[model samples]
Target: MAKADITLRGRNYSIACAPGQESRIVALAGQLDARLQHIASAVGDIGEDRLLLISALALLDELDAARRTARPSPEMERKMAEALGAASDRIEALAARIESGG
Candidate 1:
């Protein structure tokens, strides 16, 4: 457990990572910087923090949309099908009992 100091864009940040993870941290920081710069360029002039927050929100929105589009998990689908089958079985049993009594 080692601490590394990194300066990204115009701010200094201290990150904690295991040994030899500084490069990974640096690369991720670079990607974040590039994304922020791109966002700033697309929109009008704004504060760095504001732009950063907007970028984060944009990413979250995209992920939310993707989640909405994805199909339900197989286990969930199976459970739903089972529930429907059970309801169908109950209805059939009720109909049979009514016919027999009549």
Candidate 2:
């Protein structure tokens, strides 16, 4: 894992992520900062905490919308199929053993 020092609203914070994913984490943080600022500026000088909360909700709404369109990756689909096939075979094997009075 790696961590990056990020500054949002003039405050510095450390964020950690899995190896090779620092870029994505940082980019997401940047988007959050921008969204928060947008919220703060939109309705006039709302306090930082309130602004952050509102922005969080807005971001979560966006995430929920996108989740509706997300699909499993090809690798995940293949692995899932393999696992299902293995489970089916195990169940069939047990059924045969039980039927044969073993």
Candidate 3:
């Protein structure tokens, strides 16, 4: 296993990942942190847990919108659906971790 140290909302976390996935995990964390910062700026510091929940919902809304508007061939649609499913799973896992105070 590999571990990536990520900072979100000014706090650091060590995330475990498969070998060779550390950079990908760090990059995803950076994107998430950026979104969290933007949400915080708009809503003010309403606590990390709330901010995270809001961010997750906002992301899901965007994804849903995109899915509705996207038009692709059957093969491409299959690939996109698979990718979205993976992303959803990851989001659920992250939410569970946050809920558990991990």
Candidate 4:
């Protein structure tokens, strides 16, 4: 395990992660802190817990929007389906030829 110190809202917290994941954890904490700061600026000095809550909700909203937009479109889905169907047909034909001892 690895330990890292992260600062958020002017407070320091120690976090532990897998040996190689410390950098990733630190980076994510930075993102969270940035979001917290942004929220605090907009709604001046609403308690820490409230600020954290709002930041978490805001981050989740952003994640949901990204997921929705990143999903495969209808055209992409159609192309994938066509590709899979072609591969399946080739496999079945190969199996049939083997069964016939040719």
Candidate 5:
């Protein structure tokens, strides 16, 4: 096993991973820390727990959107087009708000 030390929101965490995966773990933590920082800047550090929840939801939303568009069958694609559009719009609006520091 290998351990990676990462800092997020000014706190440090040591995470264990496969021997060769230490760098990947560190990179993932970096990405997560970046997301947390962006959210904190936008919302003014509501709380670590809340910020984590919001960040998780945002990531899940992106994953869901990606899954929905990932080469679905023609019928499925047609059925999902409207819903995907709505989701994309909502995601975009949320991103805009965050970017604008709201």
Candidate 6:
């Protein structure tokens, strides 16, 4: 496992992930924090736990919408499959690099 040190909302956390995934994990945390900040701005000073809960719900809502709208034509499906495969290859390569300590 690799450890990533990241700061969100002025707080620091050490997160562990599969080696090369540290940057991606940090990026995800940043996205979550941005959502939390937006919620805070709109609603004023909610407690930390409530802010986090609301932020999660907001993101989940987005995911649900995306899932619902993702019915694609055959050609578009093929293209999306290709893109996903390429992304998978890149992730595998990054994992290999981390495993080799490169």
Which one is best on TM-score? Answer: 4
- Encode model 5's per-residue lDDT on 1-102: one tens digit a residue: 789898987899999888989889889999999999999989995988899999999999999999977867988878799889999999999999999999
Best by lDDT: 3
* Model 3 accuracy (lDDT, Cα): 0.93
Superposed by TM-score, candidate 6 places the C-alpha of residue 15 at a distance from the truth, in angstroms, of 0.8
Note the residue pairs that clash in candidate 6: none
Name the weakest run of 10 consecutive residues (lDDT summed) in model 4.
51-60
Question: How do the residues 1-102 of candidate 2 rate in per-residue lDDT, one tens digit apiece?
Answer: 798777787788898878888788788888878877777778878788888888888888988989976978899899999999999999999999999999
User: Model 3: residues >4 Å from true position, as ranges?
Assistant: 73-102
Model 1 scores worst on lDDT over the 10 consecutive residues at 1-10
Ranking by lDDT: 3, 4, 5, 6, 1, 2
The TM-scores, one per candidate, come to: 0.53, 0.59, 0.66, 0.82, 0.68, 0.67
Local accuracy by lDDT, each model: 0.85, 0.85, 0.93, 0.92, 0.92, 0.89
For model 5, the superposed segments whose C-alpha errors exceed 4 Å read: 75-102
In model 5, how many backbone clashes occur?
A: 0
Candidate 6: tens digits of C-alpha lDDT, residues 1-102:
799888878899999889999989999888878877888999999899889888888888998999988879899999999999999999999999999999
Judge candidate 2 against the unseen true structure and give its global Cα lDDT, from 0 to 1: 0.85
Sort by TM-score, top down from the best: 4, 5, 6, 3, 2, 1
Comparing candidate 1 with candidate 4, which one achieves the higher lDDT?
4
